[model samples]
Target: MEPSVFTRIVRGELPAAKVYEDEHTIAFMDAGQVNPGHVIVATKRQVETVMELDDELAAAVFRTAARVARAVDRAYQPEGITLLQANKPAGWQTVPHFHIHVLPRHEDDGVTLGWPRKNPTLEELSVLARRIEVKD
Candidate 1:
């Protein structure tokens, strides 16, 4: 398989405005900034989706994201912040690598994310939850 765009960036095959990096993750400014402080924090291992990540790698990526979020807050001082992580194409994941978007939000930034509510009953929710509940 060809390398994902993020893999190319991490390997220095492409250019990115990198902000932070550690052993397991790397962060850089998003090419299409939703806001001034928009950034992307991705796993170094290029696992495509969050479900493919081992616990350690998953934790590392989120840790780096939070760290970057703090930096963005200090730098941009936006009224709000949003950390977004998506999965497959159906879930709005354009890039196939595991990454989180740190967005500095203002009152009317033109970004809108909305979904219809199902409003299932507690019994319905419990039934759905049981299908995927983790068991030790």
Candidate 2:
């Protein structure tokens, strides 16, 4: 199988402004940074999407992302932070690997996110919530 771009970076085969790395995860400055301290934290397992991630990978990746966000907060001190993870083309995922974008946000940063908020009734929400609840 052809290695994903992230896998190449993890292997030091490509260039990246790496921030932090552990056995299962890596944090690096995004090549196309949205902000001064924009970062990308990714799982080393090379999963194509979030649904492909195992529980361990999910936790590890988030843990690393949180750490990177805190470091960014300390370094950049932006007004807000955005932790974004997209899946599939329909979800705006450009890269195939599972990764999180840790973006530092400021007012008038020119960033915009819009989606039709489906306002559900209380009963509908409760039913949907119950449907997704972990029974175990």
TM-score of 1: 0.97
lDDT of 1 by residue, 47-97 (tens): 989888888998899999999999999999999999999999999999999
Cα-based lDDT at residue 51, candidate 2: 84
| Model 1 lowest lDDT segment of ten | 127-136
Mark the regions of model 1 whose C-alpha exceeds 4 Å error after superposition.
Answer: none
- TM-scores vs. true structure, each candidate: 0.97, 0.92
- List RMSD in Å for every model shown: 1.0, 1.5
What is residue 5's positional error in candidate 2, in angstroms? 1.1
| Model 2 Cα lDDT, one tens digit per residue, 12-111 | 9999999999999999999998889999999887888988887888889999999999999999999999999999999999889999999999999999
